[model samples]
Target: MKLYIVRHGQTEWNVEKRMQGWGDSPLTQTGIRDAGLLRERIKEVPFDEAWASPLKRAEQTADILVPDQQIHVHEGLKEMRLGSMEGKRQEDLHPSEKKTWQTFWEDPERFQPNGGETYGEVEKRVNGFLEDISRTSSGNVLLVTHTVVIKLLINRFEDRPLRRIWEPPYVHETCLTIVDWDGTNGKIEVSCSIDHTKAGRGW
Candidate 1:
């Protein structure tokens, strides 16, 4: 089966540079337009199933991209929980919080959020979701999710260490990552491609 893992479109939090993990935000007009462009790009592919994160941003993107389909909302597809960091900008974080945020980008394995989930934890849950789909579905599957979730899935597919999760080619809004799953393993066909949108690179 082919997995079309897509990050949700740009949101209010994205423009504000705020921590949006597990937080909710409405999509910007550009975001909706980008998703529409992507929809036109991939409308020919017959998706057997559609899945999405429970977050409103992801759900909205899914709705815009596949309005004819019923999206199966799954908690495991949600973004990494950011706890107290949600809805706050990095500059607004306390000194210690700022340090943790830095660690998250520089040394992810050692980084710990105030009350958020660890990378390993997010990996496990997202992997479980993958396992469920691999067993129950076939053909093309669309998964609308967040940046962190997309990165973790890529790490799992590439078998990369948690420390290297923040590698290059950052996941931009509404970017598509295609994976060919052979029941157990996934091979990436495309990684963070936003050819359908006019948005700049980086998340």
Candidate 2:
């Protein structure tokens, strides 16, 4: 089976560099355009199943990218909950909170927000989802989700340590990542592709 994973397009919080976590934000106009462009880029791939995080940004992107397809809303695919940090810019964090935030990226399994989820917790849920999908789905599948979820999924696919998950290259808005899964084994085909975002007549 082939999995096509996508990070949702830029949202208002994304533009402001604010922590979005489980909080919701509408997509910016550029975000909508980017989603449309991404749709064109992968339209040739016949997606047999579609899934998305329940968050509006992800759901909206999935709707645009795979219209007429029933997208399964999976709570496990939602972005990591940032607790009190949601909607706050990095500079806006309190000194103590800032330290925690920094530690989170460096060692997510050990550091998490006061009431938020650890990276380990996120990995469990996402891995569970992947296992379920691999057991039941075939052909190509499209998963529209958030940045954190995308990173975690890729880390698991690559068998990388959870602590070093954040070290991977950043996932751009509406960027696509593809992986081939055969029940017990998986390999990444495309990491993050932004070719559709290029402005040209030949795109």
Candidate 3:
């Protein structure tokens, strides 16, 4: 199974650089247009199935790309629940809090910010989602999700420092990542890509 992943398009919180953990927001007109262009790019991979976060930002993008595709919305695929920090600007936190945030970035397994969901919590749900998909699904699949979740997914197949995984790449609007999952041998190959954007002249 080639699991394709993508981040939702530009949003208001994204523009403001606010923590959009679970705070819901819709896509901008630019986001919608860019997503429409991605619909063309998605044709490159004839995905057999799709999964997405329940959030409108993600679901909307998935819907646009695969209009007739009824994707299963998985709570496990939701963004990290930010708790008290939801919607808070990066500057509002104190020096110590900021330091803790840094620590979390360094090693997510050992760090947990105040009023923040630990990476362990995220791992549980994410792993569960993948497990179910592996046991029951077939053919290539798409997952329309967030940056952090995509980072967690990558960590599953690669051996990298937590800090690097924590600092995920710039997942430009509609960017796609392909992950091959073979349940028979328990092997997976992950690759980050911007081909969708380049092919569609979305850059």
Q: Give RMSD to native, each candidate.
A: 2.4, 1.6, 2.5
User: How many pairs of residues collide in model 1?
Assistant: 0
lDDT of 1 by residue, 39-141 (tens): 9878999999999999999999999999999999998999999888999998899898888889889998887798998887888899899889877999999
Q: Rank the candidates by TM-score, best first.
A: 1, 2, 3
Task: Provide the global lDDT of candidate 2 against the true structure.
Answer: 0.88
Q: Per-residue lDDT of 83-140 in model 3, one digit per residue for the tens?
A: 6667877798678767766766676766766677787798789888888888888888
Model 1, TM vs. native: 0.96
Backbone Cα, N, C clashes tallied per candidate: 0, 0, 0
Off by over 4 Å in 3: 94-96, 161-163, 167-169, 184-190, 198-203
Model 1, residue 67: distance off in Å is: 0.5
lDDT of 2 by residue, 1-203 (tens): 99899999899999999999999899998899999999998989898999999999999999999998999989889999999889999999989789999888787767778778888888789888887887789999999998889888778778888777778578999999988888777799999888888842255
Clashing pairs in 2: none
Query: Alpha-carbon error at 74 in model 3, in Å?
Result: 0.6
